[model samples]
Every structure is written in structure tokens, then in C-alpha cells.
Target: MKVRAITGFFFVIVMLGSVLLGPYVFSVFYLILTSFCLFEFYKLVREGGFKPSRESGLINGFLIFLFFAAQCYFPAWKFIFFLPVCLSAVYIQELYKKTPAPFSNLGFTFLGILLAVVPFLFFHAMAFMNGSENFNSHIPLGFLVMLWSNDTGAYLAGRAFGRTKLFERHSPKKTWEGFFGGVIISAVAGLIFSHYYTELTWQQWVTVAVLISCFGTLGDLVESMFKRSINVKDSGGILPGHGGLLDRFDGLLLAAPIVYAYLYFISN
Candidate 1:
């Protein structure tokens, strides 16, 4: 218990610091984060008796993130055009490897990018999402706060009053009661953030909170499903008590894109 608390405290501090420090720090931090998460995904897939193009996948995934990051810093550059060439390399490389299941390799390699990298791309976009190409820490930081609030709220609420299982198949410990608890807490956090951040109106922030709570829960369940399919308990053991970066940020996987879309529409 002490170890979990200590690890969690440092984790929160580092996450908050990364956003508050400014664009360069945030970009570098998430770039490394995206790479690590993709690596972890490919590693797990390999453990599941399948072979994914780890090298090409990592390179392409890094390029994909760089494409988005570059857009924020250097929008005029045509880095996006190179993406197809990079992705095509993945397919072409498989033609020569003569792996037992080339197609599966291809599928999981791309899946790692889609499942692990794409959402983070959206997340990285959130910093400069205001349309001015300027970085604002409020949106990303507030989003993380609400996400953490929802997780904490659900845990506390579930422990207190949790009878009805939300989804017994994928995650049996979750309950509808906990879900609502998370929503209520996240909504409150949104209202609080609106007072200070002002990046979004109160209602918009509340809506984002609701979106995070709902989709974040789904994201957790999806990761849980993936781990179960592979007969593993946690994604990895990088964090002492947190299992893996994926386990820690799984909620952001689905929630980030949805929130980004919502914020983009409103900002425009």
C-alpha cells in the first residue's frame, strides 16, 4: 500500500510537471511516452504467440508522433506525406521476413500504432488545439485532472456502495454505482477547472468530464479485455505498483481523442 501510494504520488507529480513546464517539455515527454507504450504493446503481442514487426512498427510509430508534433511546431513542413512511405515499409519488410504468420504480424503491428499511438497523437494535439498553434496547458492538464478524479471517485464510491456490476465479463470489480460516482466527481472537477482554467466554459468542461468518465471507463475495459485475451494480469511492470504506463494511462487512450474532438469543435 505504501509503495503504491508513493509511486502514484511521483507519477502525478511528473505528469503535472510535464504539462506545466511548457510545450517543449510536454512534446518531448509524450513523444517518449508514445514510443514506450507502443513498445509495450508490441512486447505483449509477441508474448501472446504472435510476431509483430517490432522494429518497423516502432520506427513508423515514432514517425507518426513526430508528424503530429511537427505540425504543432512547424506546420508548414510536409512531413505528413512521408507517412505513407514509412507505413509502406512495414508491408514491404514483411514480404522478405518469411514469418509464419505475416498477415497477423502486419495486423498487430498496425494495431499497436492505432491502439497505442493514434490516441496519443490526438492528446498531443490538445496542447495546441486552440487553433492559434499556441500551446495552452489548461486543456491537457484539466483533462488529466478530471481523468484522475474519475478514477479516484469510482474507486472510493465502489468501495462504499457497489452492488451492481457494470461489466462482469471484462472487469468484474466495476459497478454502475462506481460509474455514476466517477461521473459526478468528474463533473465537479470540470466545474472547478472552469473557474481557474477558463479554457472551456463551465458547461463545456462538464461535458468533457462526462465524456472522459464514460469513455475512460470503456478504455479501461478495452485494455482489460486485451490483457485477458493474452492471459496477462498487467500490461508491464515499469511502474512499481502501477503495472505499466499503459495501465496508468489506459483511460486516456479512448478519452483523449473524444475530448480533443469536442474541444476542437468548440474552439472553432
Candidate 2:
């Protein structure tokens, strides 16, 4: 428990620092983070008796992140033309590997980028969602707060009064009670964020919170399903109690994109 607590403390510190330190640090930090998560995903896919193009996948994934990150500054459509070129490399590389499951390798490699890398792109975009060239930390910071609130509330509430299983097949321990508990707590966090951050209205923040809590749970379940399919307990032991980067940021996978879309829609 002590080790877990200590690890979690540093984790929170690093995450908070990354966001608050301005756009350069945030972009650099999450860019590296996106790569790590993609690498981990490919590793897991390999463990599941498949060969994914780890090297090419990582390179292409890095490019994809850069493509999105560059948009915040440049906002040019021509920057996107490179993406197809990078993706084609994955297919061409697989052709020479002589793997029996070449298509499976191709599929999982792309899946790694889609599942692990794309969400962070949306997450990174949140810092510049207001159509400003400058970075605004409020939306990203508030999103993290609500995300943590949901996780903490669900864990506590589920332990205390959990009865009916939420999804017994994928995650046996999750409960419906925990889900609602997370939503309520996240909503409160959103309400609180509205007071401090005027980027979004109170109602909008609350809506963001609700979107995060619900989809965040779905993200967890989806990762749980992936782990079960791979027959692993955790993604990796990179963090003492938290598992891997993938495990830590799994909620962001689904929640970030949805929340980004919502924010973008209302902002525009």
C-alpha cells in the first residue's frame, strides 16, 4: 500500500505538471506518453500470439501524434498528407516480415495507433480547443480532475455498497452502484471547476463530467476486455499499483475524443 501510494503521488505530480507547464511541455510529455502506450499495446498484442510491427508502428504512431500536435500551431490541411504515407509504410514493412499472420499483424499494429494514440491527440487538442494559438489549461486540467473524481468515487462506493455486478463478463468487480457514484462525484467536480475556470459554463462542465464518467467506465470495461482476451492481469507493471500507462490512461481512450467533440461542437 505504501508503495502504491508513493507511486500514485508521483504519477499525479507528473501529470499535473505536464498540463500546467504550458503547451511545449504538455505536447512533449504527452507525445512521449503516446508512444509508450502504443509500444505497450504492441507488446501485449505480441504476447497474445501475434506479431505487430512494433518498430514501424512506433515510428508511424509518433508521426501521427506529431501531425495532430502540429495542427495546434499550424492548422494546415497539407500537414495531414503525410499520415497516409506513414500508414502505408506499416503495410509495406509487414510484406517483408514473412509472418504467417501478416494481416493480423497489420490489423493489431493499426489498432494500437487507433486505440492508444488517437485519443491523446484529442486530449492534446483540448488545450487549444478555444481556437486560440495559446494554450489554455482549464479544460484539460478540469477533465483530469473529473476523471480522477470518478475513479476515486467509484472505487470507494463500490467497495462500501456494491451489490449487482455491472459487467460480470468483462469486469467482475465493477458495480452499477459504483458507476452512478462516479457520475455524481464527477458532476460535483465539474460544478467546482466551473467556479474556478470560466472556459465552460457550469452546465457545460457538468455535462462534460457526465460524459467522462459514463464513457470512462466504458473505456475501463473495454480495456478489461482486451486484457481478458490477452489473458493478462494488468497491461504492465510500469507503475507499482496502477499497472501500465495503458492501464492508467485507459479512460482517456474513449472519454477524451467524446469530450473533445462535445466541447468543439458547443464552442463552435
* Backbone clash count, each prediction separately: 0, 0
Provide the global lDDT of candidate 1 against the true structure: 0.93
Q: What tens digits encode model 2's per-residue C-alpha lDDT throughout 1-268?
A: 9999999999999999999999999999999999999989998998999999899999999998987798888866787888788889999999899788899999999899999999999999999987648789999999999999999999998998899999999999999999999999999999999998988899999999999999999999999999999899999889998899989998899999999999989988
TM-score of each: 0.97, 0.98
Candidate 1 colliding pairs: none
Give the poorly placed runs of model 2, Cα more than 4 Å off: none
lDDT at position 120, candidate 1: 92
Weakest lDDT window of 10 consecutive positions for candidate 1: 73-82
Write down the TM-score for model 2. Answer: 0.98
- CA shift of 200, model 2, Å: 1.0
lDDT of 1 at 168: 97
* Cα RMSD (angstroms) for every candidate in the order listed: 1.0, 1.0
Residues 1-268 of candidate 1 have per-residue lDDT tens digits of 8999999999999999999998999999999999999999999999999988899999999988987788887664666778898999989888989688999999999999999999999988888886536799988999999999999999999999999999999999999999999999999999999999876789999999999999999999999999999999989999998899899989999999999998877777
